[model samples]
Target chain A: MKNQTVLFRSPVPVAETATIAGPKEKEGPLHAYFHYTLEDDLLKQDSHEHAEIRLHVGVLKQLLNRAKLSPQEIDCAFAGDLLDEIIGSNFAMRELDIPFFGIYNACATFGESLILGSCMIEGGFAERVTCSVTSHFATAERQYRYPLELGCQRTPLSQWTVTGAGATLLDKNATSKIKITSGTIGKVVDYGIKDANDMGCVMAPAALSTLRTHLQDTGRTVDYYDKIFTGDLGYSGSLLLQKKASETGIILHNHEDCGNLIYNRIAQNVESGGSGACCCGLVFNGYIYDQLQKGRLKKVLLMPTGALLSKTSSLQGESIPAICHAVSVEVIE
Target chain B: MILNKEEQKVYKKEIKDVAPKTKHISTLLRAFFTGGTICCIGQGVNQVLGILLPSLTEEDRGGYTTLLMIFFTGILTAFGVYDHIGNFGGAGSIIPITGFANSIVSQAMEHKREGIIFGICSNMFAIAGPVIVMGITASVVVGIVYLFL
Candidate 1:
């Protein structure tokens, strides 16, 4: 795959992840809302779809409060879930008041939504939009490709779908000292992977495609940004990413971008360790956001990635093809 | 829980050693609960959008819905709102829609290798593709089984 390059390979741009810091205010009196019902009955069963939704609904409310954002100010909503009816999201949002848009890309749902969501703001169609996706151990296993109740063994390469959801609020004013500058959609790439455990082998190719697109579109190189992070490839996938990309005549900063090497469950018995759309979310929200707010880093690129596969195709013995959505955000202040 | 003979030795060897990777979590509770707190926003956005969009939308024309929603999401993501929660909270912030967006662009800028097709492009879908493939395929099979039932 290396032909001394095509002589015109593009440079990748760089920036720091945007920043936000939030936590409940301690000085306030006890929360005045009276009707809060702590429904304890749902704890009896496995991690169901509705249970996940309920958990996520409460999480978003506090997150928004921390951000000092109110529901009335948001103009639109983009969301997805492993459930067919998107029931987790649908029911979770029943109590709030904002415009809703539904989208699906399985693991890639976040990226798909980001492309559409950012375009809305850039196109001047809306002031701000909130996007989200959800999943759970039991719900995803049952809905996606297998049933967790079966207790089948997973490979060392397998990663969890990350039983949580991440939400981002995008706006046009360039407030928050960060802004969305661009979005790139990745094309589907196929690698024959049948076992659910071996995701690294399947997704590396597509991740390569979009990373290139971002650089080519802007005529920049890898050194420009503070960090480059991919979605949930885990350890094996990230290694393969380095190996495969090297084949095409390119070398990257060791352990610079791939998501696999970032967080390890060394703390939690994470098998093969690190999977899920939320993996990146947690890292960005936890680590990257603080760094940005502190002015520790500036100019970052965030790409939400996905492997596009359906049950019919896999059962039919089809190969797995993947795609990624690349959206660039910069911290300007 | 009891550790086996060899397992006990291994645990003793590494337990107190600080992580060579990064200095992140101060406590497990902070990581778990903090990530969790942010997810509530995604849920709220969903509920809020359902009402606001339904009123503005006709029967079958919610094309710009995702766009509208993401702009708000983008703001949260951009302001470091979501990212901060992600680091302290861990996976809770990552599994959601906003985290997905942050993953790709962050990686691309991180790598920025010479071959867009290889360095950046190939890695873009680095982790997520396989999960989706598995999830979608499984959902369809379940749908089939449900139909047969």
Candidate 2:
């Protein structure tokens, strides 16, 4: 272990992954990669929150079904969401029998869960663990901004929250080429930005900080992996990260953001791009995982970034603090 | 890394430089046309009402026109059309009485799942509450000034 990063002695193998994307996400570029797509975001549920819970539960069940494992066989489940008090994950856990550890790092929750799940296996505490995250557009809008039906225009920098859920089943003894090699836990960085709508500006500093630290700790260069995936930093935020990284002598030519890749920003009418806890979750489990399995991307660093702010905090005019966690997943030759 | 005040200011300036600037001229034009069209519709409604019931006073006609506008806004909100208009029109759609109706109706419809008492009724004014508060305060102030004058 070096600084904030942990290098697993024996890399934890990813056994199976499942993704359930919403109708809007299904229209995106990675539509075919998702395991399942919901025609209706509500999924016949009355509210979006309930629909999110259903999506979360659906992805977990799909993971188990695909891996041929039962809830009893899984040692523990690590999950989180953007809902108030993380009720999406809490209510979904009610239907399952697995031990649950609810985690929250705002939009970077999936990375946190992945790092924590790998740690559990590497520490000899668990044999098989499931990591998952869920986020919904409607639920997030009502909680963070305004009512879903409100007649309001989105700001130029505003990001559309992805309505999706993704689950990854990690096993200690599984024979899988794609493995969690190491992870760098991020520190919360605040630059005193008070604009709630401009989340990209608020989170870019944190993403840059984590990327710099990860590279320094691992003695790696900018060409370390095939690509460095940042979570939910929309088009502008990604540019900001690249520019700031270059100023510090780190060239990020092979950088991609889950937020920018998940949707067709111009066609879909998304101001900047897709965001939320599930932005990276859906993209990784659906698209990136498929690519890795196909040997398209040999080694990659997954950095999920998050703007840690609540409605109360923003309302009280507090500056937004952001965090990012990086996990290196590679195929063992 | 914790940035000092100077660094924070510099970073904020950098963000401002990178963020896409809002097209003020186009937005203003859109708002003008949308708001003008909405007012024209209200006037058309008032004219039709006057032709139908000539006995009604101007005050009554104005009240009925406002009601008709709210009713039309409620329908648009229910069918999820006003939000698109709002997106295009910006403050044009939001500054009119239709905007007020949309704010209330949208909240009511969104919170309908939570039931009537705590959800729809309480949250209907969530967005429009500040406007209502300021409107009443200004009216009270005006009334007091008139009395003293």
Candidate 3:
């Protein structure tokens, strides 16, 4: 059986997020998001909350304002960031009147939140929900995977996270326009690919399987949507996704994948490809919404894939298990 | 049988075996040291990467490269190279995301021998799937407030 469902997506344009910071002169190493040097005085305090968390607050606040909503109106905040205690989202949301629930999805956090917020709204669980996520270069580096200061040259398959955050508003108002239709959750898949330098290969088969199942379960054809967006698959992952999807009979050999676009603007900075929860988040908020408003696209399917692994598990010597979730969204006149 | 060259060498002699008492102690020491070693390596890497790439390290970002280490580690684990690191490092391997990768594929291969469906062929995210769900759910709840309010 094929799956068929439609969603109402927003067309809100994102503003230039608040702050992008690097380590101080005597503080520490810099991040991979930008190459700009920070003035020493600002970097001096390094501050009460980690400067990283503070920056996330600014990004979140900026997006919230753009959505034309005030923080006090939100129910519980559905926030996730790539930090230990989810300090960025957790702390930032603390000042708000709503409750907080911190999440961790590596890069899949954004999609995960959207699905949840949509479900809650659709289920009568809540109204006017928001989904947001943040990832920092240094915080993520030090956690489950590796260090930021490694100074190691990135491979052609590597990606850089956009130093940004993305948040979306989901409501049940038919008048508001965008609708949340249906979704298909993915299971982890491994194609026996095992080169750390080649994530696209490792995760490609998983993304392919999920997309096929998602389409099949919904009983929908490929032509149903204006665009099909993915999480942080980067260049190799996107190419591999196309190759694998072709074998499955989906024939997506010529379409655009979001990860390919997020880093397109900063191609020279990355190695193999571009990815990060922010890659899709940035492009979606920064570009996709504006295009939709301009009538360039009417509908799109958003799918963000996640590779699940933990520091304890990595040390235990395990292979990555991948998952993806699909959401269909449309703009109504 | 005659005892020995000397008038009465016993043909058979009995000796009492003494079991080593350090077994438990060794086990605990191994666990503690192995765990410590893995943490040290991760901390070192974190310090170095954060130091070298100050721009990438100090702030929150949503981009492609924030995950080089996670992505790279996933690849190494798939290649069987990371498995070796696990075997040698033991708890050190188990303490990081690379260890999680090793476990998933190892279990997948073990079940694969049973046949794809009944065996290694189950959810690719069998082990880590829940974490993804919960992580996303938690974030959604928090993000709703951050964005809406």
lDDT of 3: 0.56
Angstrom error of the Cα, residue A149, model 1: value is: 4.6
Q: What does the lDDT read for residue A43 in candidate 3?
A: 31
TM-score to native of every candidate shown: 0.58, 0.99, 0.59
Give the 10-residue window scoring lowest on summed lDDT in candidate 2 chain B. Answer: B14-23
Q: What is the i-RMS of every prediction? A: 17.8, 1.0, 24.7
The clash tally of candidate 3 reads 109
- Select the stronger candidate by DockQ from 2 and 3: 2
| Native interface contacts retained, candidate 1 | 0.00
Chain A accuracy as TM-score for every candidate: 0.80, 0.99, 0.81
Predicted candidate 3 versus true structure: per-residue lDDT over A55-125, tens digit per residue: 56666565457556677666656777766667878887766666666776666777777777766665666
Models sorted by lDDT, best on top? 2, 3, 1
**Which of the predicted structures, 1 or 2, would earn the higher TM-score when compared with the native?**
2
Specify the highest-TM-score model's number: 2
Docking class of 3: incorrect
